[model samples]
Target: MTSTAATTEATEKWSGQLRANGRRVTKQRLAVLTAVEHLPHAVADDVAAAVRGDLPDISLQSVYVVLADLTEIGLLRKIEPPHSPARYETRVDDNHHHAICTSCGRIEDVDCAVGHAPCLTPENTHGMTIEIADVLYRGTCADCAAQAS
Candidate 1:
């Protein structure tokens, strides 16, 4: 497909997603979502930078608001690693986990290790039905390990 045709198709897809979530499509929203799609596991600052290419006036605060809204509406997944700013990703439809590098803070997706949603079964539920699980594994990444060695 032509570049213009592909752009139009992607825009329509993003618009459909926003409308499905009862959100009004705007340039900022479109830019932010597109940026996140291209940059998985991006922080708000990274999103803002990516967005500014298309929307030079967009603010970091606006990116944060958009990120929070997208996450609340299930359009995005927000993951927080210890001592690191929260990151956003478009992979929200499944029960996947993350692996964070202790040395460089790089994040990568880790599929559910064993079973389905709420992959890890806690010994106690406290009477609440579990729907999903958020897991974060921390270790030095290959690059970091190689550098150390």
Candidate 2:
């Protein structure tokens, strides 16, 4: 019903997924996943800081490694915005787009109006079968718009 509630739900799913994927549920992965779950589309550096707060010994490399592992196992989604560091999210498996703020480099998830992966129907197949599509809608966010005014 609320953003926080939605995030908590996602975290729970990741927790179970880690166990399902034979992961030991290490503190570093938990910390990083928690940070990313709490703040969807969070950059690795921000997640590293958050994880460090809970795990004083967790290094930035550890966070990045854990993110890569989780993504490999389908527990997390990694998003890369143009000219920005990669971000992580728990919301995967949806054919969704992203709205990127050109001014501040903030990213937000935007669900595809169409159904399923490769939601957009390409004008030409290009002689290949598309499994997924990454769409980034770039513009100034509302906050940036207000700041400019």
Winning model by TM-score? 1
TM-score per candidate = 0.94, 0.85
lDDT of 2 at 85: 83
Error of 1 at 141 (Å): 0.9
lDDT of 2 by residue, 37-103 (tens): 7889998888888888889888788888999999999888888887888888988878798999899
Instruction: Give the range of the ten consecutive residues with the poorest summed lDDT in model 1.
Output: 113-122
Misplaced by over 4 Å in model 2 are: 1-12
Each prediction's whole-model lDDT (CA): 0.92, 0.85
In candidate 1, list every pair of residues with a backbone clash: none
